[model samples]
Target: MICYIYDGSFDGLLTAVYESYYMQEKPEQILRKEHFLPDFFIEPIYIKTSKEKAYKVYNAIKDKVSHEALKYVFYVFLSELKESSTLIYRYLKIAFKIGKDINLHMHNGIVLSVHKISNKVTNEVHRMLGFIRFKFLASNLYYAAMEPDHNILQLIMPHFSKRFSSQNFIIHDRKREIAALYNKEKWVIVDMLKADGEKLFLNNNDEVYEKLWKQYFSSITIENRKNRKLQKSYMPERYWKFLTEML
Candidate 1:
């Protein structure tokens, strides 16, 4: 009935792992403090986030385990799945014991779960690279919006930053209300409000371009060869809201 509560950050989660080892106790659940609900029977222990302690666990996963294991651990964290903290904790325990061979043991449920969720997050990142449709605002900044299944704003920014390095752009995750903003030199993730995002006005040229793009999209379609099912498989209905052609 022992549970650990943390600050809901990657470093905070790592610090919880460090505390478990430091205290020599195994917690049944490791949850973010904000998400923790009081239980009459369970004893919840709050773990403070420490940069030094977090780094200790982080380095151990990379040095003791494989660097790829560290990457999988991070992807799982970004997934925001329920009981993900506990899942990661169990995965790391097995990883520490088996070292790099942990990846080879997909037969293990913990290893398999970690890999599966990590791949789900990664696949979304790959899909988003092509699916992102940017429009020019009145301020000349390029803007794009998405509501992905995972928290992948920071994950996909490196690609856009390189591809559009000469121009400023904002990739907004509407679901998370957070954005990755690049100013032609450096990129930073910041919290943005719905009103703020909605206020971005498209220039006349951009509006015309959107109309032309939509027309081109329709012109390229063959009525007889159209496959709605196949198109839905590649471009899910959920993403249609942001696609100009779909609109």
Candidate 2:
């Protein structure tokens, strides 16, 4: 058995897929080099990322498969699952063989796994859209922090960018130490350290707004009608840390 290691980028995974065919070595597993654990029984091969090779494989998937299939591959990669790389490889192998009809083959385990994982990423993207709470910063920037289960920071950028098009904002993913910064017209993702993030100060009036909002939330709640279970079902306890009312 052989294992192929990549740099953990989406392009790197595609490049590995390209090499697997050209090198004629069928790997038993494809893993990111940063997370790879040595296997005594498996021979390891390190695959370098190539934009040209990655582009060719990417185009092949879009042309040979469907545009929707291409989306599945991307979302599955963003899932950051330990076996995501291998799952993508197996998925495309079948995808290329069967073409766009691969989506209908839910009976196949590999196909089912890909769909399930991709759906999970999509679901989180939807949830984050409503869950994100922004606070005004001292610099007139809107800042919010979250620690989602998946690497979904990039996926949610479009919604916030359009919604807050006239304002500057930053959405920080505390777990990943990454943030999306938007300046009215454009947005970009950047690496942010926890210590640096802590240096950002909230606007002086932000506390007043938070207090008023919390009070409003409390005033609207009827003690007799409160259903902790239902509330938790809609807004999971795991996300309470970042919510103003929950705080």
C-alpha lDDT of all candidate models, in order = 0.90, 0.91
Candidate 1: count of backbone clashes, pairs at least 3 residues apart or interchain: 0
How many clashes in each candidate?
A: 0, 0
Question: Global lDDT for candidate 2?
Answer: 0.91
Give the alpha carbon lDDT tens digit for every residue of 28-110 in model 1: 89998877999998899989899999999999999999899999999999998877889999999888888988999999998
Look at candidate 2 and tell me the lDDT of residue 15. 96
lDDT of 2 by residue, 1-247 (tens): 8899999999999999999898877887899988798878888999999999999999999999999999999999999999999999999989999998999999999999999999999998998998898887767778889999999999999999998899999999989899999989999999987666667862335577678779999999898998989989988899988888887
Q: What's every prediction's RMSD, in angstroms?
A: 1.5, 1.3
Q: How does residue 84 of candidate 2 score in lDDT?
A: 93
Pairs that clash in candidate 2: none
